[model samples]
Target: MKLIRYGEPGHERIGVQINEVNYDVSAFGGDYDESFFASNGLARLDEFVKANAGNLIAIAEEERIAAPFTRPSKIVCIGLNYKDHAEETGATIPAEPIIFMKSTTALAGPNDQVMIPRNSKKTDWEVEFGIVIGKKASYVDESEALNYVAGYVLHNDVSEREFQIERGGTWDKGKGCDTFAPMGPVLTTADEIPDINQVGLWLKVNGKLYQNGNTSNLIFSVPFIVSYVSQFMTLLPGDVISTGTPAGVGLGFNPPIYLQAGDIIELGADYLGTQRQEVIAFQKN
Candidate 1:
């Protein structure tokens, strides 16, 4: 099922997309967050849809779309999980998955304006396939990892090279800027996707292709990532794990290319849906 949250920021209401049409389901109550998923919200949503089909309110086609789920507990990411991406950044292949956390404040709607962080001149982009944890998992076996997954969403892991590299610290410094992580046209359930590892994904800057990659090239598979991470910390329902991006980031350019005000970013994955964002200079209130 294609689940969505729509309306103005902070006021979004739950909705469902069926046969390409969107219908409001807020009457059923609750935001799609950790508690919702922990209680089998997806299954309940399915039941709700079936029971209220004719009574469901239809959302206009042009209405704004928000992220399918609420702000997760944390946005975990795997760095250089793709060989091609590692090579492009002149980094060695990891013996184990590189893990980092993105601030929950970075979360934004898929089409929201991407504000270049203040004093930032080296902003970059990464198109990643994101996993949403459904069940609480700790010390989960790799073979059973998939069972804990709730669904998937397309993610743009925006970064600032200076803070991440030049400033000397974890990638978190560059990855957690407000509006940096624009995610979701929708969060599709795991069952909706035929093959989790075979999805094709791509990104473009101002209509020019920059990233063209697929999950097929990932060094660590989805099940392994989930299981690997669970060993370190409990993955709660609604927590997001971005599987990492393939080659062709701005940092991979010969002399390096970075995002500037007025640039447009378009990215997505198969079955996960697409997103578009316009770049703008940061404004301080």
Candidate 2:
């Protein structure tokens, strides 16, 4: 099932897409948050969809969408997990994952404008696969890591290169700006995907293809990342873990291109769905 949250920014209603139409399911009494996914609300939602199939309200085309899941406990990211990406950055592929955290407040809907922070001139784009946790996970074996994942979504790991590499102590400084993390068109359940590692992931800026790669090239697979992070911190339901991006990021270019106002970014993964966002510089008051 393709689950979505739509309405206004903070007033989104949980919904399910049925036959190309969005069925408003918010009346079932739960937000599409950790509690909903963790407590088997998806199953309950399925039952509700069946029982009220005829009466389900269809969402308007103009409705604003919020991120598919509500507030999450954490947003963990893996850096340089792609061999080619590591090589492009002149860094050695790590024997283990290079992890970082993005403040949850950076989260926004997929189509939202990427607000280029004040005095920033080096904003860049990274199209990546984001994993949504379905259960509390701690000290999990790599073998059982995928079991804790609820699904996957498209994520833009927007960055400010200057702050990230030149001016900062950590990558988080350039990463956690408001509206930097644009997630989803919808959250797809794991069962819908046939092979996670082989999914085709691609990105286009203003209709020009830039990042074109597949999960098959990832240095660390999804299951390994989930299990790897769980060893150090508890992975709770609704926590997001963004697997690293493959090559062809703006940072990997010969003069290094960066996002400017009016640029449009479109990206997606197989079975995860697609999303687009327009870039805009933040205006000072």
For residue 80, what is the lDDT in candidate 1?
Answer: 99
lDDT of 2: 0.88
Full-model lDDT for every candidate: 0.94, 0.88
Question: What C-alpha RMSD separates each model from the true structure?
Answer: 0.9, 1.3
| Tens digits of per-residue lDDT for model 1, 1-285 | 889999999899999888778899998799999999999999999999999878988999788899889999999999999999999999999999999999999999999999999999999999999999999999999999999999999999999999999998688999999998898989899999999879999999999999999899999999999999999999999999999999999999999999999999999899988899999999974
Give the TM-score of each candidate.
Answer: 0.98, 0.97
Highest TM-score: which candidate? 1
Provide the lowest-lDDT 10-residue window in model 1: 19-28
Off by over 4 Å in 2: none
Q: List the residue pairs that clash in candidate 2.
A: none
lDDT of 2 by residue, 71-119 (tens): 7999999999999999987888999999999889899998888889998
Looking at model 2, residue 52 earns an lDDT score of: 91
